[model samples]
Target chain A: MKLAIMGVGAVGRSVVDLAPDYGHVVTAVADSSSAAVDPSGIDVDAVFDRKERGGVVGSGDPEDALDAEYDVLVEATPTTLGDAEPGFSHVRAALERDRHAVLANKGPVAERYGDLMALERESEGTVQFEAAVGGAIPILSTIADFGPSQISAARGVLNGTANFVLSRMAAEGLGYEHVLAEAQDLGVAEADPAFDVDGTDAALKFVILSNVLSQGERVYSLEDATVEGIRDIPASALDLAAEDGRTVRLIGEATADGVRVGPRLVPQHDALAVSGTRNIVQFETVNAGQLHLSGRGAGGPETATAILSDVGRLE
Target chain B: MKLAIMGVGAVGRSVVDLAPDYGHVVTAVADSSSAAVDPSGIDVDAVFDRKERGGVVGSGDPEDALDAEYDVLVEATPTTLGDAEPGFSHVRAALERDRHAVLANKGPVAERYGDLMALERESEGTVQFEAAVGGAIPILSTIADFGPSQISAARGVLNGTANFVLSRMAAEGLGYEHVLAEAQDLGVAEADPAFDVDGTDAALKFVILSNVLSQGERVYSLEDATVEGIRDIPASALDLAAEDGRTVRLIGEATADGVRVGPRLVPQHDALAVSGTRNIVQFETVNAGQLHLSGRGAGGPETATAILSDVGRLE
Candidate 1:
């Protein structure tokens, strides 16, 4: 498959690096500032080298790559809330042209899922965004395979940075600020970690999953969720929970009525109570019972792996 | 879609009960001794009442159901070794007639995956057998979504019966015999139970997963796996393992070179160390890292949910 990748960040770079190994060709590339276009195939290695050595990805306009010849458009840009901007427009343009869109970005799906489905109705192509939720955990595909109505609810430890802080606070009896500092030092949390630490990241993922569980019957956004962060969780609370054989985790839950993200107490031995930066999503189904999935929720190659899998679905 | 079910067992009955809810109509049904066929749709409730009231499912020739008008064949017969006959021939006949086959019987898949794939190549339809392993966990589709070559290995607690016995023995500090008896009284284990307790069940599941992961490049059977049962695990062993904060689980694993089923020590907090009759499967992937899935592995409704999902996939 011919591919055009937007957002030459960590996830995009990994996708460019791994696509060939999966028998896919990169036809166009675009970073936030510059763009490269080739109808045959882009020289991905040269683009990476240029980006590494203080040079732009290319000298072309980003719009050039968007209009380039390709079967699928991979959107991996930084997420935005309101209108979902360039990512949403890029996906819309691809779908309008009957070209498949595989999104690693959450902005479009969480905010404009209904509009995207509306576009799909008149377009010849489909959109898949498995990486929008649980990285490479296959959460969306699992829900799809099980059929939406079979799933009653989806709850999970979605944001790795919040999970890391919570896990450290529980294990070492450290305060939230202490763990946040350690996590930032370890590169698990970004310098401006408010998105993850304040529950926006996890809530966005639930919004995406809520829309999927509704089978596009509804659209959910960060504003619709009941959000709570782990910033105020005290080490004393962890110690109290440990006394009862429980651990506190930042859980995101999406049901038919609503979606919420908060710090909840899970049994210490429960599968959802995974440690460190790991994430776990469990779907409550009527006949199939509870299906639990856990893995690294955020990473370059891991998220790219999901993007690659979505690309494969276009086949 | 029109459907034909080959067995009147628990799983088959649940499929009959749930198919209509999913907008699928059963056109034919066959038990070991009787059969019914209708081009429009069968009266599934009537068929159930007949079976519950001490009569067979229907009174036609079994072959009548096979040749009836249907888009997919649901094979849920009892599993047998050696030739994997009857089930294998039924699947072949469905493919020969350009009908998709969704199998709940493990015999045909564990022993005849290559043959069935060959039939798929020559026919107009495909085969799906998620019910043959991990019941409702969506293990096969998960691997398929990731692309098989991206996975390095698959390891799991695939058998609920064995897991039930082991978990009971560990939690209650009881012997294997005591827990097996308890499991049987609770209807968790079959009266005979050898296939499950002796590791053949787990081994068969791995063999099927191995063929899937290898994309039918290799065929594995019960004879190919290194098997070990939990029959002789002493309570003292469980007690000793608990000292080190570990729990014993029946682990089934399939890699490129080999497949095996045995009792292995897992960390007490590890996701794979699930309790009771729950099952978990972990895939070691190149890019996604270790993806863990856990759920009910075996049960009438659980396995039937898998069959229903496969039916949905035929669309």
Candidate 2:
């Protein structure tokens, strides 16, 4: 299929690199400053060269993507959701043109899932957001397509930042502030990890999941459905749990009764004990009961891999 | 859509029970011994029903299900392949009649996946096997329907019996024979647990996943493919890994070349450590790099939920 990338950040580079690997044609690359397309497939294959030298798609105009005949539009940006009207609008235009949008952009799906889903449905196209929630975890697809028949509950350590913080504290007996510093130093936590620590990231993911589980026009909660930040979790509590054969994880859980997005001190016997800096989500259904899923949640290449994995479906 | 069940065991009953939740009709039940089903809605929506009491239908003959005039058929019989005529023959007969077959049974797919897939192609009906490998995990659907975009690898711990045995032996310091005896006594392992203990079970599951991964005919061999059983691993090795802060898991991994279906020891920090008994068989794709799913592998209720999950999909 003719695949066009929305940006050339880490996630976008990952998708471009894997385009040929998955037997797809990377036809165009679009960014704030630059937009490039190669009918010869030369620039499409190697346009990531600029990104290799620590630069993004620097010269691409977003409007250029409209002119190119692309089948799939992969949206991967730095997640300027509030200020993401341009990229969101770009993907929306692609979807309106009957091209499916494979989103690594959390803004379009997280903030406006119902509207985007409605748009995709109306276009008879798809807006695949597997990477938007769980990185490369396939959490969204599991809850959406597989969900109509399978899922009963979708819950997990949705935010890698909080999970990284809690995992470090529990493993090394470090205080929250110390671990938070370490996580930031190691790139596990962002420099300003408020969205993650405040549970905004997990809440955003849950919003997407809720819509998939309910399979409706859209699921919106203006009343704020129980969003508990992981910042207040005491390091001492994690130390105590570790001493008593347990682990502390910032868990975002969803069930029939709305949703519960919080940090829980899960027992060591639970799979959460294996929690690391990665993201882990579990699927609970009548058949499978409680199933555990763990993997690297935050990494440039991994997130990019997620975008590529999704392009196969969306593109 | 109206659904009729063949083999009213645990999986069948679970589907029967959850049919109401999805707003579908369970028209008939066909079992070897006692045939029973009730069109009345399932009362509770739980993962597993410990109770064994339910409304039953028809005690006469298997042909009764064919006469029910159903839209879909749920085939949840014991594994019946690599022998004489398998029970999937019954499933094929239903397919020939133009009914979509939701198979929790892996026997036919493992041995004759190509033929059945061809038959489905001819019939333009589906033979979904959601419960065949990992009940309610939804691995096949992800790879088949949505994987065209970004799939790379099909890997996971496909066997729950093996996972449970390893978990028991490693966590509690039990021996193979003792755990084997206990698994049987507790009705965890099958009568001839070769499929689980050996890599045959995983090998069969790989056949199903391969179809979705490559969108080509599943070509494999239990002989040529690497098959390593879990029985050969010493408990002391598991203990040694624990000493080094790690865990031992029976990983059934399938990559591009062939498949590595066997037991392998991985790090405690790895995602494989989180998978427990009756749990996930995850798939790592190009788009969705690593999707870890967990659930009940085998049993009546989990199988029933899986079958019913497919019913929800067809609807």
Candidate 3:
């Protein structure tokens, strides 16, 4: 597959770097301000070197890369809320051109699934966003393989930042402020971690899962989710839970009725109580009972692998 | 698709009962002694009723069902070790006729994967044995989706009966013999539970997994696996592990090197430490990092659901 990547972030760079290993070629790449276009394949190392020394990836408009010849458009832009703009428009441009869109961005899928599907229905292209949820874990494709209706409910610890904070607090008896500061120093949490610490990030992922689980019977957006983060969870709470052989995890659940993301009490030894940044999702299957999938929920290379897997699935 | 099931055991019965729900028709069913054959669709409830009263599924010879016309052959027969007979022969007959084979029997897959693939190569049919591994866990399909070469290693607690025994012994501080007795009494273990408690069941599953993970570069049989059962684990061992916040599980690990099944220690809070009759498999991917999948490893309906999922995958 020939790929055009829209974004020069960690995920986009990783996708460009690893495409050849997966028997794919990156034809074009675009950062916010610049674009690099090659009809055959882009010089990945040169693009990254140029980006490192200068702010621009190439000496061309970002729109040039969007218009470049490619089989699939990999949308790895930063996630946004509400209208899911620029990202949404980029996907639309790809679909309108009868090209497939593989997304690592949560914006278009979580905020505008109905519109995305509508656009897909009219085009020769398809949309796949496995990276929009559980990074490298094959959750979305698993749901696709096993009919969506067969899954009764899905619940999991989705936000690595929130989970890290809670687990650290539980493990070392540290306060939230201390752990957040430590996580920031360790580069585990972003400088401004509100999106993750406030439950919105996890909420968006669950919202996307809810949309898929509903099978278009009903579309879910961020507003439909009942989300509560770990911001208010105290170290004392973890201590109290531990006394009863339990721990706290920021869990997101998507069912037929709705989606919920909150700090829930799970058994101390439960699969959901994974330590550090590890994420786990449990599906209540109708016939198979409960199925749990866990892996690195977020990372540049991890999310890029998901995008590549999605690209591989495109027909 | 029209399915011909070659067993009247629990799993085959569930497949017959649930075929309609998955938009499939069971045209033929066979027990060790009798066969029920229909070109269109058989009466599932009537077959079960006959089996319960008369100890036979129908009046015809078992060979008749194998000869019946069907799109897919579901081999749910009792698993035999050496030569993997009659199950292997049943699958061969189906493939010779260019019919897809979805197997719940582990024998043909664990012992004769190469032969099975050889048969599939010559015929128009393909072989799928998801139910032969982790029942409802979707482990095989997940590995297939990720590409076998992309996965580095796989390790987990795969046997439900052995897991039940180990987990019960750990939680209750009971001896292995006591737990095994309780498990047998509760119907979790068979009367002659040598296959499961002796690690052969888990070894066979791991052998099949190793075969798949190797992508036919190498084939593994039960004899190739280094097997160790939970029979030797004592109450003192469980107590010692608990002191260190760990538990013993019949863990099976398969990689490019080889397959090993034995009682191993895992963190109490680890995903591999799933309790009761539950099963879990963890895959170490080259790029995606560690991925854990857990679910009901075995049951009539659970295994049936996996068989149905495989059937759905067939073209």
TM-score of chain A of 2: 0.89
Backbone collisions counted per model: 0, 37, 0
Q: Give the per-residue Cα lDDT of candidate 1 at A303.
A: 96
**Candidate 3 falls in which docking quality class?**
medium
Q: For residue B133, what is the lDDT in candidate 1?
A: 92
Q: Rank the candidates by lDDT, best first.
A: 3, 1, 2
Instruction: State which candidate has the highest DockQ.
Output: 1
TM-score for each candidate, following the candidate numbering: 0.98, 0.81, 0.98
Question: For residues B1-315, could you state the per-residue lDDT of candidate 3 as single tens digits?
Answer: 999999878899889888899999999999899999989899888889999999999989999988998999999998899799999999999999999999999999999989999999999999999999898998998887787888989999889999999889988888988888899899999999999988999999889989998988998999899998878777999999999999999999898779999999988877788889999899999988999898999889899999988998995
Rate residue A83 of model 2 by lDDT.
Answer: 39
| Residue-pair clashes, model 3 | 0
- Give the number of colliding residue pairs in candidate 1: 0
- Residue-level lDDT tens digits of model 1 in B55-144: 778878888899999999999989888789789988998999999999999998898777888899999998999999998899999988
Q: Please write out the lDDT profile of model 1 over residues A1-79, one tens digit for every residue.
A: 9999999888999999999988999999997788999888998778888888966998788888889999999999999
Cα displacement (angstroms), candidate 3, residue A227, comes to 1.6
The ten-residue window of minimal lDDT in model 2 chain B covers: B41-50
lDDT of 2 by residue, A1-315 (tens): 888787777777777777786678877887776777765453753556775564555355667765677888888866655435766787788878988788777777666666777787879567777777777666665555445445677777778778778877777788888988988888777888897898877877776666677776347441345888877777788778878878877777666676668777788757655455667777676445665656667666667666666665554
lDDT of 2 by residue, B1-315 (tens): 778777666666777776766667777776664443444422332212312444334444567665666788887777764631445676777789888988887877766666677788878567878778776566666555444445566666778778888888987888888888898887778888997898788777776666556566445434435778888788898899989888888777666776778777687656566444655566655544565666566666666666766666776
Summarize candidate 3's per-residue lDDT along A1-315 as a digit string, tens digits: 999999988899889878888899899999889999999898888888899999889988999988999999999999999999889999999999999999999999999999999999999999999999989999998898778988999999888999999999999999999999999999999999999999999999999999999999999999899988888888999999999999999999998679999998998877788899998899999888989999998998899888888888884
